[model samples]
Target: QEGVKRWLNGRDDAAFSRWQLSRQREGQFIDLLLAVRDELDRLYRQPLDEPSMGQRKARLFEQLRERYQQLKQQWGGYAGFDGWFSHDLNNAYLASIATYEAWVPAFQQLLKQAGGDLAGFYAASRALGELPSPQREQRLQALLQAADP
Candidate 1:
């Protein structure tokens, strides 16, 4: 009975430690998210102050591509190699969605502040001067299929 009680107490202490570690990780994740956003803001908004469409488009695309690269690196590590692989993926997905949400206002403000047509600029931005919508969708679908665990 005494041994069982000691084991239970040990388990409880370990569980509490794990819970604390999880909270610390969450805080770090938030910090990472904020840092990414700050990078995006610096890339997009600061350049827009001088008002160059080409530069704005380039900066925005660069930031978007960087985020995608970062996410893939975070999420797609080899099995049993990366300790936080699953956690990284989940955090990346959440961060990507949050970043998109953050962009809504920045985009709106850019259009209003710069007196540009937001929809037209965005449509052009989406095109990225290459493949059409259908081809892009097909490529994305293929990538998603490939990415499945």
Candidate 2:
């Protein structure tokens, strides 16, 4: 019985660690997404009728492409960005901005609930994820409600 308890505890610990790592990766993704969004916004905000608009857009795209190539090198040849910039830039910017706007407040609330304990936040997130779909949605809604100032 003691051995079984130990094994279960070990499993739970591993799962918690995975969740923590997942959250870290998610934060990285959000950071990259925001950077891309900002670059696209800078291009979009320029007047279409500006004399050098095409040139400016081309310069911005080249800059963004260089950044993406650097990121790929940093990430050990990760191809995640291969088609990221090929899509409609405005749609991509809107989606990224929407994700950031929606994610930050909920993450803050989770941190608050955990009293700033990252491990505790991961455990809570794992628990919520383990619930049935309906229950998970309900719990998420409650958390969002509590998050409201």
Candidate 3:
């Protein structure tokens, strides 16, 4: 219970939102998620003050790529480990990596044509919008139910 409490990261639910554990074991998976979240928040909070598209391309995207790389590393270890958490993380990693891989080139091209206009980059990037949640998340949710009280 002590470990699970820590794993919950102070959440009352204690559920992974994707599993109803009969017993709590090592909370490495949740810890990894927290690490990923912290890193993302760290990177996202940085103000991208690059005034020119070239600068934005060089600096902002470098940071973005770095975040993705961090995620890739986080998910890589558990990709095929044959559990719901591993499955979910790996799926997230794969989808996010693929989408970002495509977007890097897209952003580069957009920056080239953006004529130093951040709005142009914004307009073009906004076209990509939000991607649908990966199927694995749903599967994991279904797999999770109320834990035995």
lDDT, each prediction: 0.49, 0.66, 0.44
Which 10-residue window of candidate 2 scores lowest in summed lDDT? Answer: 1-10
Over the stretch 7-120, how does candidate 3's per-residue lDDT look in tens digits? Answer: 674475646433334232224433344445445445446775546534543454345445544544665533332343333243246346445433344455544456646668
lDDT: which is higher, 1 or 3? 1
- TM-scores, one per candidate: 0.29, 0.45, 0.25
Model 3 global lDDT (CA atoms, 0 to 1): 0.44
Candidate 1, residues 2-106, lDDT tens digits: the string is 233445556798766655555554454445556655555555555355557445645644554455456546645312222333342333454575766444443
Which pairs, if any, clash in model 1?
Answer: none
List where candidate 1 sits over 4 angstroms from the true fold: 1-11, 48-149
2 versus 3: better lDDT goes to: 2
Which should have the higher TM-score, number 1 or number 2?
A: 2
Looking at candidate 1, what is the lDDT of residue 79? Answer: 26
Q: How many angstroms is residue 101 displaced in model 1 relative to the true structure, after the best TM-score fit?
A: 14
Clashing pairs in 2: none
Model 2: residues >4 Å from true position, as ranges? 1-26, 39-48, 91-95, 98-102, 107-149
C-alpha RMSD between model 1 and the true structure: 19.3
RMSD of each: 19.3, 8.9, 19.6
Model 3 bad stretches (over 4 Å): 1-88, 127-149
Residue 46 deviation, candidate 1, in Å?
3.0
